[model samples]
Target chain A: MTTNDFLPAAAPVARLIQALHKLPGVGAKTAQRLTYYLVRMPEEEARALAEAIIAVKEQIILCSLCQNLTEQDPCPICTDPTRDRTTICVLEEPLDVLAIERTRCYAGLYHVLHGVISPMNGIGAEELKIRELLMRLNGGTVQELVLATNPNLEGEATAMYIHRLVSPLVPKITRLARGLPVGGDLEYADLITLTRAFQGRQAL
Target chain B: MTKPRTINTEAIVLRAAELGEADRLLTLLTPAHGKLHATARGVRKTTSKLGGHLDLLTRSALTLSYGNQGTGLATVTGAEALDSFMSLKADLRALSKALYLGELADTFHPLEAPNPPAYTSFLEALQALESPADHDLVLRSFELRLLDLCGFLPQLARCVQCEEPVLPGGHFLSPAAGGVLCPACKPSYGDALPISVDALKVVRYLAANSLSSSLLVNVRLPLHRELAALMSSLLRYTLERELRSTAFLRAIAQQWPKAEDVPSRTA
Candidate 1:
């Protein structure tokens, strides 16, 4: 039996529970817990959370240049002068841009495709931001294109498709190296990962 | 209360979709259990042990556990890759064909029903795709085999209408009637497609031989197109909807050079 079978919540409370249940990982019980918590929360805090959500929806827009979510036209990364303008790292989502930025290892621009090419899901190259990426390379300023899509099958297919289309435009095209995880044990490594690590071995 | 049953089986990762934040819902095809929909928790995380093994189109050995009287979705507890088909995944054209095969197998085979022949045909097709053989021929042979296994094989030996022997001449294949219609019966079936004598012969040959034997028969461009269209029509009729991968296969086929045009290499 569900929580509602025990006691019927108020219309507003039930409505809130239904809305929360639509989220990615929230289930019926979790939604009810959140709903009851909201009922007990102070008005000021609840209003603040609601207003923050609205602000995010209203103010944020895709950056015209790199297609990353940003408040301004060209994101700060695209306009940053200290960053190398000769290289661009192509990624599958905006979150990936933040992941790479956290590393602080590479200083280059980024392009977000927003998704990978998955035929099973009815997603093709045309569905992604590929045409925009090609247009970005037409200026002839970029020299290296790094494909940082995930190492899964769909990601690899997307990278291959983009590489075939953009190879003539960019002088150097490279894909992210696949290997064993940093903290994982070598004995636990899968064969594919081990083979790739061997083939992509670096010289000391 | 009895404990949940744990079963180990070899499976092909046919389709996968995101579940919660870090989980993946996979559609796997197995020889013993047919198709299974299971959820792999934390598979999207970088440190996941099951992530690399459960990629789409990869065949792997899986350990699945069922609870609540086996009505709920199975949970994947362990996974190890058997054949990743690396070469096929590296080439876009071949990858498209392999995915189509996976989708076709997923469509024809029902869940919880043991179908070893269907499963074996799909595995063989994936293996054949990794070789330097003709990819289209492999697909044609797989389609015929799958259609036969599913009891949807088009009547090539005789006319579907009158049940008479199909003579050696131009005939029409009727997807609606589920077979070829002789010229005398073609006017009765409006949905029939014109099939040349050679095309009929090729289709018959594919149905009669194994996938490896089918690869030995070299087909020119026109006959290849005819067989593709005929098989596509039969599949569309059987499934009642065009598969998403069909369009991708056609789009990529147009971009690549014809198989006949590429000179064969001899040792």
Candidate 2:
């Protein structure tokens, strides 16, 4: 499977590098290095990488309400009737929703922002799916919005952005309680602490 | 996809995602780098030796084989436990806060990027969580510092628009524009929050001072409140979105009896 034996230097390996380099944060040097490595990789390993990429594209879709990636439209978390509906814990990414679920402390709905607000980065409110979140609040079923974005500058900005936008639309909008490390995410909290947070939820 | 580079570091296991039946996709934050994801083959099976050291927020030293061969994620070579925020496990509020911090750290820090300042800040925050110093202040300070380290520290020294210094006393922070604004400058932005002088001071303290310095030794509630307000505004301004963790934190705070509601510790 070595590239030396597989094809000319100008073949698919070159094409793959070009493609990989376009991804966020992947430098061209990294892309080329990876493409060369993949050239030498075993056939099965190469297929696996291709498969994972395809699997996400083919199988994953936004959970209807939470907008998180899921094979299902509503996602497991959103469909579970056992979960609390009045409170929706809002987060920045799909991974965050998963992180919270792992704790088993939260049995409520969620809303994923996909990205936080960064003015310097030129990401504004319109860039995010916040307006969609406001639509969720309009139904009047949700009573609280638990802002679970990360605790960084962007995370804080994103949370405050949503609070001002959604607070007027919803009955309550509360930020995550502050004992957690600042500039951190909600996805990494342990089960016991997450459980306590779930049990202790208060009105905004 | 680049060839995954083999790397070694001391890390804290933030969480594990079950992949298929035997493998686990592990998320970790290291002292050298920041947040990263790696696959641990067959670690979910009973015979796997890395189980104890790989739980949520458990610190460990790990060697990883680059993910270049497949999956672009790292594969764990070995792991050894350092110390666990075990107490956080028993206390729900504490644990939630820890997760919030860990998640924030994981999100902000990138894999394979060296962020010693972030690493140290996270380490100190976790340690502080164990002891329970004014948790709010600690969290706010950590946030302020993290933003500073990330180079997004909110501009407390001057107004975002006018470039004039933000005078002490009641001012406003414009989330739409990004940073504090003087009274004259406030009307230019629509979505600004009224920030008190105390809050501005806390913001300055958080943005200007280092955690290793004499900041946290003596924190006042007024400062905490101000920080909370400033942080809320600054973060909202910066991220341009809301965090679920902030809401969760506020929710938990509400359930706990006020200091006045609870009897004095010595009495």
The second chain of candidate 1 has a TM-score of: 0.93
State the lDDT of candidate 1 residue by residue for B1-267, as single tens digits. Answer: 553588899999999999889999999999988898999999898788888889899999999998867558899999998888887888788888898898899888888788888899899999999898888899999999999888889889999999989998778999999899998888988889999999998899988888888999999879889999999888998999998887667766775555432212100
Native-contact recovery for every candidate? 0.38, 0.00
Q: Put down candidate 2 lDDT per residue, B1-267, tens digits, no spaces.
A: 554377778988765665756777888887666677888887654345565457667777788887456446688978766676656543445554676777667666767677887888888887777775666766777888888898777677898888998777768877676678888888888888888876777667766776655245566776667667767776766766766455545544564435333211100
Runs in model 2 deviating more than 4 A are A1-204, B1-5, B67-71, B212-223, B258-267
Leading candidate by TM-score: 1
lDDT of residue A197 for candidate 2: 61
True lDDT of residue A131, candidate 2:
79
lDDT of 1 by residue, A58-84 (tens): 999998889999988898989999999
Instruction: Give each model a TM-score.
Output: 0.93, 0.53
Q: Note the residue pairs that clash in candidate 1.
A: none
User: Model 2 chain B: which ten-residue window has the lowest total lDDT?
Assistant: B258-267
Model 1: DockQ against the native?
0.40
DockQ of each: 0.40, 0.03
- Over A91-114, each residue of candidate 2 has an lDDT whose tens digit, in order, gives 988878878889888888999989
- TM-score (0 to 1) of chain B, per candidate? 0.93, 0.85
